[model samples]
Target chain A: MNTAQHGTWNRLFLAWLVAAVSTLGALFFSEVMRLPPCELCWWQRICMFPLMLLLPLGLFPLDPRVVRYTLPLALAGWGFALFHWLLVLGLVPASAQPCRRGIPCGEVGIQWLGFLNLPLMSLLAFSLIIALLASTRQKVSP
Target chain B: MKQKLLFALAAIVLLLGFFLASRLHTDARQEETRQHTALNQANLLRMHSPTLGPAEASVVIVEFFDPACETCRDFYPFVKELMAAHPGQIRLALRYSPFHEGAGQVVRLLEAARRQNRYWETLETLYASQQNWVQHHSVQLDQVWAALQGTGLDLERARRDMEDPAIAAIIQQDMADARALRVERTPEFFVNGQPMPSFGRQQLRALVQEALRTGGN
Candidate 1:
């Protein structure tokens, strides 16, 4: 009802758009590009993909209360993406890879600039989306 | 103030994406151009590999396949169709990657058959009847031999040559080369040394088309 909460709509919608793109990107790599998704990547996707639908429903009426529902999911997705990136970077060990397929999860099918891969890109995207959502929550609560 | 920060970060994400897309586009173009030059001007054929097209063909498909791989069996007809359709314009250089149990022995037999000039027949027979020899958990060499009984191959000489160190060495070389190219799965392809960016017959066909555009018929 107040001006402070009015612009939470911007943050919420943009974060939703990012989550939407992230979901589609994951599908594009797996389905279109024929790259297999690792288990951790799948967990991150499980956490992130629902936001694509849930956030928009929250935004239809521009409710600041959406933070109660979205933040936890964003946080969880961000955690998974961070862990997956760590596994891909070899900052963690192979024993931690957690997948037993013919192809290893940490296998660098696409490496760029010596430190960037799909997982890292995913981590960065979720982090931004989370930051935006949390900022909206800060303005929304009191 | 919050909106400003959010929009600023969003702008950066969008800009980073554009930068990556443009850089990748340039890199792919450069790489394709490099391969086009090699295909047009150089000879990269493997003299010992089994082939299914004319030597003077402008487009060449080099496929690394395993006889026992289910995916390779699935792609067999598609690769055949590509060759059949293009006739002399598309050539396929078949490389062996024996990924399953006893696949190396079968590859050895194929090589041994090559010595007797029955390479194509043996490959066709093995692929056509892949189920008889390649089992769920094991390979039946006797069944494979039985399948080859009337194909006019000298079974005794094939058995002897299968054990030959020279035959073993070729298998070793092909495996080494596949690893160097990071071929993780069966039916991996390179069109005139242009690697498919993804796994699909359509990707292979597109790369072949690109190569033919440069190399010419």
Candidate 2:
């Protein structure tokens, strides 16, 4: 394969890897860390989990347009995560918070580390996937 | 081609590393919050002298109650209902608060009843019949003791345990715990060491169910 072909594969593979790790990270938080997922986290996960299948499908057929198809869905997922993170950080009023099991999502822990909590991390992962997909699509078609 | 694969792997690893680092930081924050919570709860437990339930139970329900408080009397049925719904899942730790007139004597009598292993039955009976006895200020202490005759309890031991200093300390520690938790009224409930907000019975039941589902982990 030429350098361009190689680069295209690399970008797609990286995107898949990042998406998988993020999903697994979410699982670890929910199952092992015992932090229950709020409604927003669940929505993000639902959007991302499909990429586990989509990534491999895109890789085998060498159809970069596949990434385009998944990109919109993934972007929408990130939007939810970003909105949830903003609600958690109190950038917005709690009326925007998602309710799960009768408890508001904002009431749970806010930021994790200096920046990333569940929602922000999810948003970052989704963004990375989007960037990789876009880059790979450009390499394949152009 | 190999270099591209190497770059991809490196980028993926870096992303994972960043995520792990952030999670570690969150874990540290959670640990600090947990420690602060535990210490606060311990202090409250020490002050209130609340009765300790079986240490083996997965969930602990600590309650602050005044024998003569109408609210406390009203909450008794709810408590009984909860216990009935989730048998052995929860252990009830009752702390007597003498904030109301005649509550101290009633608490003593209830503690004394524990010597016969009839503490719960006696407490339930008293709560169910609170209006009948709580207002009789001139009633003799022995008459209260006599009321337990048909419950198949040891009347003598029940009377004796009422004044036990050890029991008094337990009750006091519970009161302190309630104070620390900022519980100002009777019938305040704490599920697994967390202060429950004022909510309806359905909401409270849902909270407990969620706590159970989470295994209190």
lDDT accuracy of residue B191 in candidate 1 = 80
Fnat of candidate 2? 0.00
Docking model 1 quality class: incorrect
Candidate 2: how large is its RMSD? 13.8
Candidate 2's displacement at residue B75, Å, is: 26
Docking class of 2: incorrect
Stretches of candidate 2 above 4 Å error? A60-65, A107-116, B1-217
Q: Show the lowest summed lDDT stretch of 10 residues, model 2 chain B.
A: B44-53
Q: CA lDDT of each candidate?
A: 0.79, 0.70
Q: Per-residue alpha-carbon lDDT of model 1 for B50-136, expressed as tens digits?
A: 888788888888888898888888888888888787778988888887888889999999999999999988888988889888897
Give the best candidate by DockQ. 1
**Candidate 2, residues B1-217: lDDT per residue as tens digits?**
4554665576577568766866786677546645655668765343334354455767777777777777777777787687777777766777766676557777877777776667778877776666666554333345555555677777677667778997777767666665665566677766776655443566557667776787776
> Could you give the fnat of all candidates in order?
0.00, 0.00
